[model samples]
Target: MILAVVGGKGGVGKSTVAFGVAAELDAVCVDADLGMADLPERRGPDLHDVLAGRAAAVEAVDESGPVDLLPCGRTLAGARASDPRALRAALSAVEAEYGRVVVDCPAGLGRDSGAALAAADACLLVTTAERAAVADALRTRELARALDAGLVGVVVDFAEETGPLRGRFGAPATALPESEAVRRATRHGLPVGEVAPESVVAERLEEVAALVQRSTRSV
Candidate 1:
């Protein structure tokens, strides 16, 4: 299944959550954010090359990592040259090879982000505890529905419990408390599960991974 891990607001731990879930599921984490790409870097053709017709999707995959990643080029020119419409075919090739594909979507419900959602079988919305963040998540949830993507649920990052997020968007929620492990792992461009296997944040991410897997079976 292709699962899009999205956020309405930036700085909500969206990419980190995407990396963690992909690591737990042994899935390919595609950095779909062409402009603001945030996954670990690799020295090769990346998502930019794929979208720009310079490389095949499979050939761009970097396997030597805490997890497999279809890294995106961090260049304004590359992002401008990329065609959002090409993402569908690229993602299709990935889904063909990997049993599970997790897309680290860019913030907002823009054309690029929508393309990611449209290519997914299911989605996992990411947000923080702020009201504005939750509001953005609601918008993201609506976008997922409009695209007919199955939403696994919402994940409230940097929180101890579900708090007031339960049933907010008509979906189940899993809250991950603020952890130094998450900050540290992300700071070093590593998966939290690998860096802090025993931390509470890693445990919650594993639970979220299980939830994403269940989304596949339910469909």
Candidate 2:
């Protein structure tokens, strides 16, 4: 399964949610945000290299971290040289080898984000409780539908209340409340389950993961 974790804008804890879900699923998380890679970095050929034809997709995966990741190069030249069209094949290759894959998609409704959603079997929308963020997520949901990527679930990060979000996106929504433990885990490139397994945030993330898994199975 290839699942794309996406947000309508940046800084909505999209990468954190992607990493957490990947960890829970035991899948390889690809940093598809070529221009602004937010996941942990490693010394090896990355997604940019794979997209640019310098390395194979399976060879670019780095398993040294808490989550297996196909990190992206943090260079403007690399991002420019990489082809977004190649992402579909690259993600397929990873899925064939890894069994399951999670993509940390670039923010917005641009070509890069479209490429990720187009290649995914399904997607999980990540957003905050703010009105503007929710609005953007609604727009993203439409794009995902247009691209044929099924929307399995939604994750509301740092949510104060989830009452308004339910049934808004045509998918079940899970709220992750504000927590210092989650913040620290994200800062260190670790999942909340690994850093604070007993915390409320960790349990909520697990629930979110389970929700996604169940939704995918039914699809």
Candidate 3:
């Protein structure tokens, strides 16, 4: 299964959620945010190199973390040189070998984000409980439909209240409470489960992972 983890807005913990889902599922997480990558950096070829025709997609795989990663470059030059259309081929290679690939897509409906959505079998929308963010997620949902991708579910990160959002999206939404463990895990380049195995955040993410798994199985 190839899943694209996307957010309606930046700074909503989309990448963090993506990494956690991938780690829990033991899938490869690819930083598809070529221009503003938030994943941990490694000293080697990345998604930018793959898109720029400088490196093979499989060759860019970095297994030095809890979950395997295909990180993106943070430099402006790297992002500028990347070909958005090349992402299809890049994703194909990883999906072929890994069986499961979760792409941490950039925010908005831009070409780069579209490319990742187009290549995904399904997508998990990430957003906050705020009205504007949920509205933004609806736009992303439309884009995913345009690309003929299925919607796995929605993940409401740092959610303190979930009442108003129930039945708002056509798909189910999981609310993950704000937790300090998420911060520590991200800072240390680890999954939330590793940092806080007994935390509510981790348990909620496990439910999200199960939701994704069920979606894949149904397909």
Off by over 4 Å in 2: none
Q: Flag the better candidate by lDDT, 1 or 3.
A: 1
> How well does candidate 2 score on lDDT at residue 143?
98
* Ranking of predictions according to lDDT: 2, 1, 3
How many backbone clashes can be found in candidate 3? 0
The lDDT of each candidate is 0.91, 0.92, 0.91
Worst 10 residues of 3 by lDDT: 160-169
lDDT of 1 by residue, 136-217 (tens): 9899999999998878888898888887789787778998888889889988999999999999989889999988787687
Q: What pairs collide in candidate 3?
A: none
Off by over 4 Å in 3: none
RMSD of each: 0.9, 1.1, 1.0
Tens digits of per-residue lDDT, candidate 3, 1-219, equal 889999878989998899999988999999999889998888789999999999999999999878899999988999999999999999999989888999999999999999999999999999998888888989999999999888888888888656678677788888888899999998998889989989988888888999899889854
